[model samples]
Target: MGDTANNTENAPKKSFFKGVKSEFNKIIWPDKQTLAKQSAAVVAISVALGVVIAIVDIGVVYGIEQILKIG
Candidate 1:
């Protein structure tokens, strides 16, 4: 009865690390060509988003300035 309790107590910690090790071994890293392609995609998307935000910012600022001028 005591051994059963002890086993149940330690079961989770042992299984957790074993599962982690199993998952880590399954990883297949990208090759150089794939890495470069993905990197470029990320950079391109980031720059596109920045440009969009800048345009929106400029529009907002211009609108506020025109409103203030009219008042």
Candidate 2:
């Protein structure tokens, strides 16, 4: 009975490792040029978004200061 329980617990772990190996075999990895282009695109968009948001935030703060007579 104890041996049966031990094997039952080990069965899932064994299957999990086998499944992991099979999945790694099936992956289609991106090549170097595609990877670089995608990375640069992500960075450019992120920087443009950050600059726009910062400008909007500064404009809001300046407007609020004018309303409160702080400037």
Candidate 3:
């Protein structure tokens, strides 16, 4: 009974890896130029978003400080 339970647990893991391998094999990887462009776009967008968030955060902090001073 114990052996059967262990085998059942391992069976799912084995099948999962097999399925993952099959899916990976089907993927069409991007070429070097396309990959480089995509990576650069991602980096640029991330930096822009970070700057916007930082500006918003600073504005909020300054507003809070002004309110505290008024109080």
Candidate 4:
């Protein structure tokens, strides 16, 4: 009875790792050229977004300063 319980517990762990390995083998990884293009696109978008945020911040600060001066 004890041996049967131990085998049942270990059976799931062994099958789970086997399933993980099978899934990894099925993956189609991206090529280096595709990876580089995607990385560059992400970086360019990040920089463009940063510049837009900075411009908006400058405009807000200037507007607030003008309002304070009017008071």
Q: Native-vs-model 1 lDDT? A: 0.96
User: Which residue pairs clash in candidate 4?
Assistant: none
lDDT of 1 by residue, 1-71 (tens): 79999887877687789999999999999999999999999999999999999999999999999999999
Q: How many residue pairs collide in each prediction?
A: 0, 0, 0, 0
Candidate 2 lands at a TM-score of 0.78
Using TM-score as the yardstick, the better of models 2 and 3 is 2
The digit string of per-residue lDDT tens for model 4 on 1-71 reads 79999887777577789999999999999999999999999999999999999999999999999999999
- TM agreement with the true structure for every prediction: 0.78, 0.78, 0.72, 0.79
- lDDT minimum window of 10 residues, candidate 3: 7-16
Which is superior by TM-score, 1 or 3?
A: 1
Worst 10 residues of 1 by lDDT: 7-16
**What TM-score does prediction 3 earn?**
0.72
Q: Give the top-scoring candidate (TM-score).
A: 4
Residue lDDT tens for model 3, 1-71: 79999887777577789999999999999999999999999999999999999999999999999999999
Better of 1 and 2 by lDDT: 1
After superposing candidate 4, which stretches have Cα over 4 Å from the reference? 1-11
lDDT of 2 at 18: 92
| True-vs-predicted CA distance for residue 24, candidate 1, Å | 0.8
